[model samples]
Each structure stands twice: as C-alpha cells, then as structure tokens.
Target: MWGRQMFHFLLHWMLGAICFGFLVTAFSVLLSQLVITVVWCSLVIGASIMQDRDLSEYSPTGSSTSKHLSCSHALCEESPNCASPKQPCPYTANYYSENTTSTGFLIEDILHLASSSDRGSKRLVQAPIIIGCGRKQSGGYLNGIAPDGLMGLGLGDISVPSFLAKSGLTRDSFSMCFNEDDSGRIFFGDQGVGTQNSTPFLPLEGKYTTYVVGVEGFCIGESCVDRVSLQALVDSGSSFTFLPDNVYEKVSKEFDSKVNATRTNFEGSPWEYCYKASSQQLLGIPSVTLLFSVNSSFVVDKPICLVYGTQGDNHCISCCFFEV
Candidate 1:
C-alpha cells in the first residue's frame, strides 16, 4: 500500500510539469507577435530578419547597385545602362579619338544590279551604291535621305549583306577621324583630303548606319570640271538619277558646250547634273575611292544614267520614279 501511494505522487508531479511548459510556450508566442507588430510592416521581411536567413546577408554595392537603382526591372543589368563603376568610358575625353570604338550608319540590305536578276537590276547597272557594313544577326538598318526625294522601298524586301563582304568593303578599324572647321560643321577628310561634308564610306559603328554611296569623278564634255563629287543615291526602284544645283552646273558644262556654268539654282546649293555614261566611259572615269584607316579602300566606278526633262536643257528634277 505504501509503494502504490508513491506511484500516484510521481504521476501528479509529471502532470504539473507539463502544465508549466504549456504556459511558458504560450507566453513566448504572444511576446514574439507583439515584437513583430511593433517592429516590421511586412511578414516576409520581418520573419526572414528574425530568423536570420542567409539571403538577408547579401548586399549589392558599387556598379551593381547603381545599375539596378535607376533602372526598371525590364532592362538587363549587363547593358550599358548598368555599366560597371570599374570600367571607364573610352569616350570620356576626346570622343573621336583613335582608341574609341565608334559606330557608323547601317546600310539597307539591298542587292545591287550586279547581284540582281531582273529589269530593275539592269536599270541600276552603274549606279553608285553602298552595301551593309556589319553582320546580319545584329539589329541594324540603312539610314539615309533620298536627295532625289523618291521613297518607295519597303522595309521587308531588304536583306543584310554577308559578314565577309561587309568587312571587306568597310573600314577595318573602329576609329573615325571627324573634324569641324571654323564654321562648326562636320568635314570628312579622305587620307587628309577634307570635304565640306562627311567623307563617303566611313561607316561609324554605332552613330549612323550604312548610307547611300555618293559618286565622285571628273565630268567629261565641253565645260568639264576636274574634281567633282556627285552625291548619288542608288535606288533600284527608280529609273533615273537626280543631281543637286551647283554640282549640276559643273556636270552640265562637261556634257553640253552651250550650257551656262555660272548659274547657281539655289543661293548656296551645290550644282547637280546628270549625264549618260556608257559602261566604257564609266571604266575610263577616274575611280572614286574612299580610304579608311581601318579597312580596305572602297572604289566606285560606274556609268550613272540620269533623267532629263522635256525641255532638254538642264532643269532641276524633283525625283526619279518607275513602274513596279
């Protein structure tokens, strides 16, 4: 009877200990809830910090933070928007310097007459043209103004040039030599020979895309001038070429002896003229070449066929168009 009474006493002591443990656990949970309500506004951040999670220890600094801080989540951190603070800009000082990686105009990916297999190809047989200068996979296009004012080429019909061909035709280096005269206008110097405008065929890597190739050569005839550069646009959709004002005066003098050479159609515009140059004459015309410090020199030798007005005398034509 004394041993049975000792067993009941042991059971009572165990029950009391279990009740004390339950009270202490309930108090701890209430205190934790109160601390979180007073300290944190969100559950995830509060719980993670309280638990001392591993992700909470990470902190982005330097360019990593700067990149994401000012940008939206849509942009990639590796883009120029997120440039590393450690990497310096090559264009910080002189932007047009030789060491800088420059961008040029993207050219429209249209095949020339040499590559065409139809009548449209034959019409542009000797027109001055420019091919794309970069790879196809890269997102780029030809950007230029039609001096002839004719626009009909669709965006879908073009194709980028082969990489090997583009590389061979464009500047081999990433550097461009641009100069501004006292007038603050840009000038293109061909191997130290400066032109009033940007040099032809100097494809900047990023700035401009492939533009139409301009024609440069002496006009042959009665009133010919030796050094004339005709800004020519090769349009497969057109049947004729158009020249601006002062440039035409010099060219007309070469074709017709009676043509007046002193007339400037517009105030200070360059005279533009067009003449039929047979393939034989095109071969004889001095090769118009643009030499880039980076790559191989581009030479233009073609017989450009231009449209003449009903009056027959040199009249400024607006644009050249043909039936598709």
Candidate 2:
C-alpha cells in the first residue's frame, strides 16, 4: 500500500511540475487566490450543533475561564463576535500550546471558497482544516488569541495542497516566492521544481504526517561540518525549529562559543537562544548550513536576523529544523 501510494504521489507531482505553467497561462480563469478570507457567523454555530458538541464544553481545564461572559449575551471580554448563544465558542485544541504540557481537544473545520477566477469561469473549493483554537496557555501571554484561525499546509491529506489536488482543480504541486517585506504569491498547478537538484520529501513512520527529510548534519562557520546526522521534519507550521534537549544544549554551547551571544526573552517566547544584535555583525559567527540528503544544502544568513518588537527595537537570530 505504501509503495503504490508513494509511486502515485510522486507521479502526480512530476506531471504537475511539467504542466502547471501552461495551465496558468492558457486557462488564466483557473488561477485562483490561495487564501481563505472569511467565515460566516452562522456556519460556526451550526457546525457545533450538527456535530452534537457544544464548543464551550471543551476547555483546557474541566472548567472554562470565560465566566466573565454575560450569560444574557454569552459574550466574553475579549471578543464580541461570540456574543450570542447562537455563536460558536472556541474549542480546546490539544498540543496547540507549545509552552506548557496542558491538554486540549482538536477543532476540525471546513473551508469553502472559490479559487482565483480570471475574468472567466468560477470554481468553488472546499477544504478540510485542523484549527488550533486555544491560547499558548490558559492566561495572559497569548490568551484569547485562538479565536483567529490558522491554516496548515503540511504533507497531509487535509492540507490545502492535497485538498486542491483531490478536488481536481489542479495538480498536486505549489510554489511560493516571497519578498523581504513578507509579501508573497503562491503559484499552484504545474509550478516546476526549479533546477534538477530538487529533493523528495520522505515519509515519516509516526501517526502524525509531515514532510520528513533526511539531514546529514549542520555545518557552522563556512561549510565545515562537525558530522551530525539525523532526520528532520520540514514543518512550516512552526515559527522556530525544536531540537532534543541534549542536541539543543550542544548546539547552544557551540553557538555561544562562536558568537558573543546575548540572550533576551519576550513576555511569551518559548525560545532560549535569542540575540539582540543582527546576524551579519556577529564576528566569527557561523553561517547556518543545513546539510540534507541529495546534496541539498540550505544556507541561512539574511532572514536569520529577524527584528521582532511592537516598537521595532528588538532583533533575534534563531535556527533549527526539528530534528530527531
């Protein structure tokens, strides 16, 4: 079963890479905007009813912190949208909070939309989505932030790419080009794999699905590799890559030795390795080189130095691809 599935998956992507460019140009009407813009109030409330589940029942604790909500209006202090009893309450999504070991439930939802329509035909797209609908914790830091939804584009059947392909609107392929300002466009359909050095994303053994890639090791400072081999998940869902405790300690020591590292923390950040200065200015600072299989090496330098602050004074230099 696995062999055949892998064969077909790769086959479709190969065909998609070859034909997507022509399709985008010729049938411009098929080019659809790759985003979910909104969700109506009725659907949320109705889905809760339809599933026979009260969104309010599932909370991080056996109880809920939203007691401040007026039973008369059923509204919380933070958001007025879930004001009515008819409105859908957020679910307790588990493992959604990375900072703590709290347990939560999974909130599965659906997205219905039309792909980008050129001045021509219109096609509606329906996708299955797993939404993380809880705060980083039960309180202050990112509390009440879960109501706003997030879209996952992982290597799973429920992901947007898989949904589009299954719906027969396009091939199982997509590409993205982004700018330094964070503005970008995602090209779907026969977006070719640029260059022949493209590496195949390997399948993982566990229940959770992800695009696991084979990593040889990380080379710090120029292209020198200290010989570390491992498998890593190429998860775009995460803002920072996570490593095992021992491995993180080793890398942290090496990073400190290389660069005069200054550690800082945000009010809610879950990271330990942070820097106040830009990545370029760190003397003897190693350029992070990720050595993956098939001779695929990713070098990080510019984006490594990120400015993160409400007032624009803070900067952080972080690196990791979740390794095991």
- Worst lDDT 10-window in candidate 1: 10-19
Query: Clashes in model 2: which pairs?
Result: 20-190, 32-116, 33-116, 92-105, 94-104
Worst window of 10 by summed lDDT in candidate 2: 7-16
List model 1 lDDT by residue over 1-324, tens digit each. Answer: 011111010000000000011112221111110010011112333243234432221111211211111222221122263355433211111111123111211221222222233365523321222221211111111111111111111111111122213334322222123234412211111123243234444222222232333344443432226554433322232223334445444444444443333232333422343334444433443322332232323443332333344534333322222221
Model 2 TM-score is: 0.51
Name the lDDT value of residue 196 in candidate 1. 29
The TM-score, computed over Cα atoms with residue i paired to residue i, of candidate 1 is: 0.23
TM-score of each: 0.23, 0.51
Off by over 4 Å in 2: 1-93, 98-148, 206-208, 260-285, 303-316, 319-324
lDDT of 2 by residue, 237-310 (tens): 23454554555556555665566656666666555556665545554456766676878887655324465666
Our tally of clashes for model 2 stands at: 5
